[model samples]
Target: MEKVVRHRGWQWLVGVWCMLAGHMACAQARTELLHRAQENLTRVIVHDIFSPPVASRIYLYANAAAYETLVLGDSRYVSLHNQANMFPKIDQPAAASHINYELAALYAFLRTGGKLVFSEPMLKDSSEHILAGVGEVDEVIYQNSLRLGEMVSDSILAWSSRDNYAATRKKRRYAYSKEKGKWTPTPPGYIDAVEPYWSQIRPVALDSAAQFKPVPPPAFNTDAASDFMKEVKEVYDVTRKLSKEEILIASFWDCNPFYLNTQGHLNFATKKLSPGGHWMSIAGQATQRAGKSWIETSKVYLLTSIALFDGFISCWDEKYRSQMIRPETVINAYMDEKWRPLLQTPPFPEYTSGHSVISTAAALVLERELGEGFVFDDRTEMPYGLPMRRFASFTAAAEEAAISRLYGGIHYRSAIVNGQKQGRGIGNQVIQKIRLNAGIGK
Candidate 1:
């Protein structure tokens, strides 16, 4: 009787050990899967110089697909297929077979990311290698998960086809405006304006691009004493007197993918994140810092991406509508001929700053998702060889990002201030419309 009792006790200990090991493995998988998504996104950003609006659209669709697929395995989150204006139909899994959701998420990212990015072979091979690591222990479950991921990707791509992204690509040419106070390509390449038709793209949350138009910027005035000229003077004078800290702030938020290198004639350009990519990295960092699970992290990315997508649309509507001049153009025309902005002015109309709008919009969603007063060290820009700056909260970082445009001498005060207000409106709409739940949607 004593021998039999000891044998049963040993079996119980072995079962508990297996359970603990399985739990640990699951946690590690979640962490790795999230990190993998962030890395691939950075890859696409660095692949070429995508304009801010185009980059936002890419981020939105990829993340939306990943979020939709991930939430299918867990009911704690909701899908945005029908909630967002025109997302396509995604079929639910046919069977209740056990799925490793982490594997499914990585697979979903692979499918959507491959379709959106230029680095298709690299992304596809990366996914296959990752899936291989899951082992052949459960081949049937693995195959089903991959199929589900592909199904989600196919639906997302179908929806993306109607967003006017490809149509805009055929008409990429934009006419230059030589009129005073109008945008002119500045410094560096001096290429024609980027994405002049961006506002025409379909918005994820906004009813239309003009749904949340910001007030027009102050009218251009050539007189030295006029308010418009005064604002231009402010940009010129502030740039002239920029402190070291101010310079760092401007450099930190530059987000110009093809900023001039100036190191050599052969290598005169360096690639970095666009404004949208910068905010996406911030969202990923915030989600990780909050110790969120993969399911919860997907929500953060989805919300932030959608906010940025619509924010860009609203910002671009005001940008082209106002056709207001950039500080670069104003300062050179009316203030000082020799003056150059502390940063390179991107080739586009400047009313309603893009950086300010997207950054604040992303901050709003992040704050709502992660709560206020969250502090974290930002290493997202570190890979670009910039120093990591710590922030007290998401708003603090966004406010700095908004003001950085001023310090960079790229935008006037009105554009920066008004952009934040416009962004907040869009962010609120995303929150009000999207629903979250722990049950499957109809």
Candidate 2:
């Protein structure tokens, strides 16, 4: 009887020890996973600044998965599967693979909730999903996994989500009409008062779709002008040459964020431009105190604040309507292959430079709001890890930069000239509309 009792006690002790070890391993895995996810998410956000919409959506979904993981502890897998159903349109094989990994991880975390050991299959699936998404080969995966493993082994490290980095408050005082129940727009003569300065500024233009003589389409291969094709080829070559997924990821990442409509206004306002770059610093300061908090940092507010979006949209609509070819395409084949641009050509039809129209319109709006004397420092930085450059007035910055593309071999001088003129017209129209709508100083 005594021997049997002792044996039973020993068995119970072994069982308890195994359970405790499993719990510790599970906790370590969760912490490590969270940290890995957060690092990727940060990179995604930074890269999104220049990216288009489709890629940005994928990153958004990844972020959402991480958030769910954090909230539900080990139940993130089930949560993601549920969420995947919400985005019914994202049924691509690649996306489905990612969903499966999340599901597996969630299951492992839940099954061993608080246990120390994670299922090997779950870890493998998670790692595979990440690798597949970025197109990294197995070797790169091993390196990332090793780094994560080292971090996991350390008990003190913890992971947290990145905070919202966008500006989200209004700085100006605004009132809505009580009787008519509509927000009052800014006054009309407000913009006309600023028009004289525009006449002093140089105009920018684009390739004439129809000439004064009405010539036929220039005889040339249009495919040579395709920026998309160039990008695809460049990406393929980079992947082959470097064999580093990080570089490829960085390239794609750089182009994704700008595509999204979210928080651009806040980003633009809060973003420090080059000194003497553009706009009145006083206007940036003045609007820092007006209206609803959320509206203040909105893209609409910033663009409208300077009254540039109106002219920008008008010019854009007309430019695209004409659909002119860029100089990069024309000059390359007709001119020389050795002729390279100083600045990369923006991907779009070139009629009027979008930057010129928008920048000039903003300058006009800023001059009106803050008067001609208001000056601010420019602090805009270059994309990627490039060095920062400074400027003087927004108009000076706009004009020089617009012209720089010509010097850079990307745009024709004509396009720059016509763009500037079209932008001015658009700015004047926007000012008139705002004044008429606002019932302000007419």
TM-score of each: 0.91, 0.36
| Strongest candidate by TM-score | 1
**In model 1, where do residues sit more than 4 Å from their true spots?**
1-25, 132-137, 262-267, 438-442
Collision count for each candidate, in order: 1, 57
lDDT of each prediction vs. the true structure?
0.79, 0.33
Give residue 319's lDDT in candidate 2 (0 to 100): 43
Return the TM-score for candidate 1, rounded to 2 decimals. Answer: 0.91
Q: What is the C-alpha lDDT profile of model 1 across 135-211, one tens digit per residue?
A: 33366676677777778888888888999878888984777666667666776567677788888899988889988
Residue 34 Cα positional deviation in candidate 1, in Å, after optimal superposition: 2.0
Regions of model 2 farther than 4 Å from truth: 1-300, 303-308, 382-392, 436-441
| Candidate 1 clashing pairs, residues 3+ apart or interchain | 75-438
Candidate 1 achieves a global lDDT of 0.79
Q: Which tens-of-lDDT digit does each residue in 1-442 have in candidate 2? A: 0001121343344435546778443333233333343233333333333122122222233333232322232221122222221222111122222232322222222222112112324433344333232222244333433333322222111111111111111222322224321112211111111111111111111112111111122222336465533432332333334433333222321221222122633323112221112232223333342221211122222333223323433444444344455554444444454543333444444555555555566666555544444444432233344333343554655565555444444444445666676656555544543331122442
